[model samples]
Target: MENFIYKITPSKLNGTVNVSGAKNSALRLLAASILTDRDVTLENNPNELLDVKIHVEMLEALGKNISIEADRILIKDESFNNELVWNKRSIRNTVLIAGALFARSGYASVPLPGGCQLGDRKIDIHLDIFEKFGAKINFETGETNDTLMLTKETELVGQDIHLPIRSTGATENSILIGSLAKGTTRIFNPHVRPEVLDLLDLVSKMGAKVEVFGQDYIQITGIGGQSTPITPIVHEVVPDNVEAITWLMMAIVNKSKMEIKNFPYAHLVVPMQFLLEGNSGISFDEASQTLSVDGKNATSFEIATGPYPGINSDMHPIFAAYGTFAMSNSVVTELRFFDRFQYLEEMAKLGANIVQDKNTITISGNIKVKSETVRATDLRGGMAVLMLLNEGTDTATITEAFQIERGYNNFVTKFNALGGKLEKVFPESTKEINVTKEALVA
Candidate 1:
């Protein structure tokens, strides 16, 4: 299907939704597994997302045996082909494999990856910093797909590598290489997101010594066990904080009582603190690892998004949608991703008074948005549109819903279970665009 057309009406969700496993965590773990021949079993993995699917296929092509279900994955990489056919469209996660592939077989070849348009997600940092540890790379930009071939001259020696910016992909590549390199490797200015922390923990179980000093520095002591056998351990993937925050918005905007299970509140303390400061009606039960939100005292709030342990740039749109119906103005400053407000125009269709200036967005609250046809441009932005639809007056249609499905698993089913008025209208089931155009002309 090209996209999903969501037919929605004004409704409040009063039930619960179990968030999916973190796509980020699962993919990185998959990459790190290449360093070992031991079987790796990951529980609570999010296999539904499109990105995860692509990575699974890529790993299979590398001669890894993978068995996947809805929430569990068992993978064993005893041997892999040195040559890999490349697809640029979903290159983001595959870039991490360079280090692990080199560690296992001393050779790595894959096409350059080109993924979503979230700015500054380049692989140059991964390539440049990996070279510091003795990985040789040849790059030639091609018209159809840029081919990248990587080989190791010798075993990677432990060294200190500094990143100008804390890019997540670069940090992960360094960790994968450090796990198999000689001596201790220190990474400066690493992006210490929860997913990264989970990856470090997983590798530690696999006999890689890893340490974190504060949020900016990560130290990993290499096993230096090239061609040596490794004992893999069972690891459960971390819960998805982004997905948790999305469902939290659902509970509040629908003005309903909801409970979210398996919520890792520590990883999400920063954004959750913002909601608390803003008087969002939510509370946590640490004993049970659940968050309870009622439809009471949903207040207006302002937040500034930064790196991890701070407000995430992904949370910008979800909160923008929630604050639109608040009692006052909710000002958002997106310091990380500037062009995240593309969905504001579609939001305005719901009678939301949202003003955008450069990287800042100011949303006027207490106004009831209209139920009208709008578009979901990106993953996070598409979710924001869904929250806006709940606060709308009547019916609404959300276009390009595949963007939402990219991250959310069982979106329509979960939303409907929570008393949400949502349905996916397939293009085949609905009127064809070409036929509709012809009818208009006639």
Candidate 2:
């Protein structure tokens, strides 16, 4: 198999761009599909994402019938397969898949979850949740891969699960398992994120009685042992707030004008406040569902990431890129993931001067970075590099370009639609291709 790379040329963004469906929300919906036996239809799904594609394959391996028509996905399962003999790489959503299967048949065997090297994302919390739900958990370690097995000797009994921390996966799994448990399950100290809310919206449409009382707790009344004959549902996914911010930052850094459609104004209250406070040229028209930016006032600012309704840890990299184009210095403190500085080294390849002291990073802006070969260590980190490269007037290669595809959907076409220059290049030999700046911009 030939591995391809992304070759980016200096280009300016203009015109309108539509936001795709949320990757985080869609994956959870796919896993939650198994909670009911009826066919579930999801609209506005970003099926182009590599992670979603891999998860679709995983669902098929478990005996679900999946059909993709344009941006919509229809999932149907006539007969459930509790065990998954997966041969391909698995995603972190497999944990949710286990919970759904346990709710269906009381037993599930799935390959261990695999995802980006984002610090220590342990599954101990998930195991604890399952154990609290009256299920026995075991880990079968193999030479090449490991498998997580869950079994229940009796019906799952609902109980109060108080999360030690605001972990998203643990909270989502609680809802999945609680939907079919014998009684009502209440989750205290849950991470009430937008994606979590989306999942709640989905399962509710499929006949799960879920109620939210602020951020304090969530209660789900299960359908008991009779898990079948669930109401078939059609739902539309929420827009990707992360991608919306990505386009906003990219247009501002490149000094371009862009109008973002399908904009989820409600989900971006905090991040947009920060941008407006920093004097970034931005305006939103709620009636039209459009956000327009001229990118004339891009400047340095300060920010710290936290949980939902705040700047996410994933948004830090791009915000760092946004600060990199300013005439003054910018500071960012990552309070969520302290060890996410692996992308800093790769950013330096493009002349980014970032100093790190523990979880805080000070980015010295006003430096013009030259085009150079860089690697995409993770999904968000890779997109940050692409935005930085777009701010330049030369050609650069991004090795391991597939990392970007895990989140952003149809990025190449969308970039070109906004007058940004990007090309997918497959190497014929070991030598790299060089293009003149004038030729690239022409």
Candidate 3:
């Protein structure tokens, strides 16, 4: 409920947990599903996130036969409309859909993308790359939302394009369209985040030819020049690297003995380096694939968020929370999203001495949270408070729990499995907490 608040008391979490399917990967895969006329089943995809639901609702609006059986999403064969009719006015994935729609139907009308508003994730690169492939791009402001129409009267032929930045979104959009476009499309300076690799694998399984050059170049050969039919696919999403990192943070911040199973170590090579930062309490079991930590002491850390393989921009708020209890100073420079550190202000409510010197966040001193209530401004920012709550010496209330729910699947249950004592309080309910609260105690 909108009026509900989460009361999370400080506790230690210890258990093995599986990260949900990559939301980023699933969003792009959902968009890529439109490139096919055959049934597309995505295994391990979570259907509950608000962004995913919004994208699915948009697909259903365009006559996509979508159904869910447990964690697998069955998208039956259906004719897609030429117009990009989205239920939500804006989602960052819309730019992605525009690319897929243009390739599949030769026309796409999408509202300017909006989702997880950290900063201006510009679509200029998207439009520029599409234009390189001879797409006719136009912008018109509408009453409800400003629409970006990408119409290709002729077939989309592959082109070699160099991206100034290795953007995951831009790369995904390019790959989606390029997979269906006539001829070969070569993307230079592409982001090869594990999630992007997952998309490449998904498309390759669905009949496209993709080649990776080290890490930055992705060469895609379209499926028989748009004449070939898309083969139906059954693909599992890549494990969420961020979620794995969250559990790692949980291990350190809570300072509890914990085992995090299904930890994606390969994708986290760069991030893991920073998190470890010569810390002795955490160790990895390569054979068993577990990250275990005993919270005997806090490890000092400093990091700067960049593109993929670098620390993710989304991790800034989370690590900021972890920085609170570190034995020494931790500095984070968020290069991707300018406004990402805004959540740090809220964490200060818990007595985190986080100071922003321009884009870099300087966090000093170990803190015991005195925060009673705080707001979750954005998706990841919202989760930051929960990390802060885990450090609460007393009970703390985190408002806007929906933001966390949007991205995370079974948030409370997973945390509870790790020994977290959290409860949802509904102001509108006649009872303090709904009957569902009994499930925890039971």
Which candidate number would show the highest TM-score if scored against the true structure? 2
lDDT of model 1, residue 279: 49
lDDT of 2 by residue, 1-442 (tens): 1246999998878999999999999999999998887899999999999889989988898889999998999999856789988755567888999999988789999978876767767789999999998888898875444789999976787889999988888999999998888789999999898899999998777666899987799999887765455567899999999999998888887778899998888998998876776555688999988999888756778889987888888899989988888879999999877877888999999999999999999999986877999998778899988888887768989997877988999999999999978998777773343322121110
- Would you estimate the TM-scores of all the predictions? 0.91, 0.94, 0.91
Candidate No. with top lDDT: 2
The runs of at least 3 residues in candidate 1 whose Cα sits more than 4 Å from the true structure, single-residue gaps closed, are 1-3, 140-144, 226-232, 278-281, 429-442
Error of 2 at 102 (Å): 1.1
What ranking emerges by TM-score with the best candidate at the front? 2, 3, 1
Of 2 and 3, the candidate ranking higher by lDDT: 2
Q: Whole-model lDDT for model 2 versus the true structure? A: 0.85
lDDT of 2 at 283: 89
**Per-prediction RMSD in angstroms?**
4.9, 5.5, 5.4
Candidate 1 root-mean-square deviation in Å: 4.9
> Which of 1 and 2 is the better model by lDDT?
2
TM-score of 1: 0.91
